[model samples]
Target: MSIGETPARPRKKKKHTGRNIILSVVALIVIAGLVAGGYLWNLGRTFDSNSSKITDAFPAEETRPEVKEESKDAINILLLGTDTREVRSDETEEDEFATLPGGGRSDTMMLVHIPSDRKNVFVTSIMRDTWLDIPGVGTAKINRAFASGGVPKAVETLEGLFGIRINHVASIDFEGFKGMTDAVGGVTINNPIAFRPVHNKSYYFPEGEQKLNGEEALAFVRERKAFTGAGGSDYRRVKNQQLFVKAILGQILSKETLTSPAKIQGIVQEMAPYVAVDESLDATKVAGIASSMLNIRSSDMEFFTLPNNGPGRSADGQSIVIPDMDTIEKFGEALQRDTVDQFVASTDLSK
Candidate 1:
């Protein structure tokens, strides 16, 4: 207490305020960011592992066109579906490669066009048996491109035929197809005619609206031959496919699915194994597209099938779907010019 002695500095009082809370928040945010980063990194690795990159997929002229990213210019995705099962044997890896031709035949193929407005998506299914010119390979069945050259060949064939750029490609197994249907809680399709598919006589779908679970849905889509109505044609099958797709969109955009990000992620994880995507279809690309298109509802999507003549036998004795080149050319032009709206308005044959 000596007068000359400096009063002991009062220890700075520990303040309980926003700053303390802010510091704690900042620490939490940093930790959370690190964890999220790690999770995303791991997810990316998983996606990359399940996919095969196509270096020669696109021809030289394809990379030329310039369009604003995520604009109304339209983004095109080539979706190839195959009934390929993952059968592994004790055979060496080299033998495994030998067993797969092109990349295994894509039983179903479609071009998914997402216009810039983000209001709706356009899906056009291509008949798998269409005979067409495969770039650097001889003319053959469209599905044969995968068997001859893998996904790259398939992509190249389609891109060459269509005269447009395919931004990404996703090849999916039948299990993935079935799994996705189930993940979306199954799809409800309106059957134009009641028919039991020859592929599976065990089940029958009555005409009109039908709510189908995964197995039933797959059967519904695959029943082209058993359809006695309209000759049970391939085009008929395409219609079934389109109908099922619309139902899927409805299910995915339903409040039940969109409200739960964890559920969506879990579904995607389950689908990953049965899917093989292009190198460009990484997590960042997918996330960016999904975030931008969040406003799109199932009602906004439209589906169609590429124009094709009825089945015919080729000179080589292969059954094939002949191309309706005139209509297809118009479609290609509309697609190239990003005027798919016009194409859909006038040339959507499936309607």
Candidate 2:
């Protein structure tokens, strides 16, 4: 046979190589499973078993004594920051400066609303000194509700004051706040003025964007006198708090911080332990809430203190914040409908 003819003698049948195809199929399946697992895990953690009980406190017209699908969608959470300087279980002697039971007060109170649609989250900070009705306790300082009966009383006070249903409550102690700030490395704030803290004598930051560590961040938020200038007071301080929150949020949502697993884990661990959620919430659930809020940009979140005419002495002789009822009612109406524009319009900064 000719050499060419012999070579052409049927090339040995090439066996179909299925190995690569099989490996590819296996890889796809594994990826799909991981994606599905992650989704399920997140969903399962979004709402805890006791969600109903905790949410029952806030009664929507449609949700009260009845079941409604729409009512389930909108959620309002009360964020309370207590001053527990003296109530430490490990402490033998009460520090004169401790705020909790013996000395401390509620330094900050914020109401966070996460709409059912998950479009954006709205946060409103209530000045701790705002005197309002405390349900069964009658009228009193808002911060005292925590000391009188812990979170339950505080929730009652908020429900009475705002006439809105607060679905959940989350309390984070001071140490947790510090740790969270540290975990995120630090937060940046725009300091338009410079001053010093009366209590700590720490140097205040100048007007500009400043990176703040845990301690400095805490001081910044709590520094009323410095931010208010000669007339520095809680009103200005609350505004600054709102600004600080926005800055912290900006830092947190930045690509550099959110994408880093190690940093994220550190933040989660440090924050989770110090947080006390209503019986309904846990770390996983809170994480889901945070995830849902990822879409709310720093600019989208607007902050305003309750409009007040001035500080006045109550019949009991104690100082009290006199809220502009007309404006406050309008703000409440806006909150009920989840409209930021209405709320912002009702606020006249000129006061």
Candidate 3:
């Protein structure tokens, strides 16, 4: 070896470390893909097998609001929560739309809006006692629309009021709250106010963040009687419900839950039995919708109640919540224009 001749370079032994690392990563990715694919397939099957379907849930196209070009890709889903203890066996389908389960008296109503960008989800709660004109039934509480004409009438009334088209409807019995809460191994929520659920007085929820099991969650979301005065209005219940929603979404999306195939499967199976969606929202459609929103996180969800005057009484002396149409109309317009983010930013959501 001559010192000045760049010491006869020893031929470098071939290194396979980089290639081996690449191969190992590719193999792991393939295995993970297989596992995830199998898990999702099973989940879809379970969801389809247990869920119920509603036919022709929407009203006539002429009667509902027209979808604007900017809002064409946005999705609006109406979620109804009902306490259906009695089943009317003699009910008949009216105007092609089948009567919703629990005879169509919705206790909880929310309009879920997902914009075209899919960056955020907005949920606006509508009080059951809100006074609005029901189609074909004249003036009445909004909830009466559901009982009078089921899904079609309910959809018509809301579409007319907001001037925004509703794309889908999903009805869930109150019993679902328990099963879903338990399936997710119970949701942990921050409790702003403390109270006991009306049905179960023994379960007291204290203020601050706490974990609630199935029974406790049911009570927490359903305890309207515990609140009194201005704060006790349906606003409290809606707030609690919204909080539960955010908490459950966080839990379901957590790495611990998403990584566990059994937990994800259990959630779908348990929730499906109590849910009924419009015919178009089948398991495959649902999976597609979920896939599109893969980037969404719990923090991206925004919840607010439709603006309304505190409380009022109808002409007949029945108590009601008077909607602040002036403000809500602006919200609706934003929906049509697909500028809800700006509308939400400029407007006050304290109500």
Candidate 4:
């Protein structure tokens, strides 16, 4: 609801390690606030040179959407959590959560809409398994759009589908999630259901309000398969991911967290190293956005999934989500008209 909810810039990624994907969301909020608070310069000049940049990620003229902007206006960003395929043999110990699909797959994607007044933030969680067309490539799972073309391709794919202009893009790895989470001293969540986490059966949580440290939170979100009898609900996991992000934002928004420069810088330091952001998301951009959003509060936030009918087997037997086009178009229209509040109020959020 309040400012410091997420990084002001847009970001993207592959392979939805539910918790890791949300880390991108966390980084945008944490780092952007640091820049606004003057902690950025104190961190030194290495900040700019240190972060990896995604090349040619902006959409071309022909494919671009018409957007209106003032010095202060609404911003649409894509936060991506990716599974980078590089095999890091240098590390003495393996990061258990980092092990994922071979190709760079944005395991999780979130499109955040920040209104002009910045009173409230509306978020849409995109299910990776949703069947859709990729620009230059044919129809496939939406997550695969990033595999070969990287950030640019993924941005184009979303632009094509949503018909909205993306102002910034940030991509982060799984390891960054844990580091950032721990830096904030862990998060407390109202666990909706209790089950064994997907990757590690050893870690289990009861259905109740609980506090989870970095590692436990990561496993908490990844547990889609254990909750339901049929097992593995991508949509269900997405809800968990959304709640986790909101909870983290709430943690940072408190007076104690915001006043503490060390905690903010610590998150930025741990998160910045693993983030790959588009050219538009510099300290200047982050600071400009954060300064205007200092009044935001947790109650001003809203979360929902994208519209999809149900799941079906592809021709080749691959499982995929069936998107509801009529519903998607209306949502896109709301984004373009800057009437997200009305749209969210009138329609049902994706299940």
Whole-model lDDT per candidate: 0.70, 0.64, 0.82, 0.74
TM-score of 1: 0.75
Estimate, for each residue in 1-351, the C-alpha lDDT of model 2 and write its tens digit: 566565343434222236657778899999976865575454344333222223333333442222234444667888766555544353222112213322334677899877677776778777665677765567776766765665566766666565567777766665666777898988878776676776768556777878889888777776665444322477777777778778877777778876675676566666665555666666466666776776777777666666676677778887667767777677666656666555575567444
Off by over 4 Å in 2: 1-72, 86-104, 225-231, 345-351
Per-residue lDDT of candidate 3, residues 47-161 (tens digit) = 8889888778999888987789999999999998765544335322321122367454466889999999999999999887788889899988777787677789989998898
> Residue-wise lDDT of candidate 1 within 296-349, one digit each (tens)?
887777787778776788898876778898898888777777777878887648
Angstrom error at residue 195, model 2 = 1.4
What's the count of clashing pairs in each model shown? 5, 6, 0, 29
Candidate 4, 224: how far from true, in Å?
3.2
TM-score of 4: 0.80
User: What's the TM-score of every candidate structure?
Assistant: 0.75, 0.74, 0.87, 0.80
Worst 10 residues of 3 by lDDT: 90-99
Candidate 3 Cα misplacement greater than 4 A, ranges = 1-31, 85-99, 102-104
Error of 4 at 278 (Å): 0.3
Candidates ranked by TM-score: 3, 4, 1, 2
Q: Name the 10 consecutive residues with the lowest summed lDDT in model 4.
A: 91-100
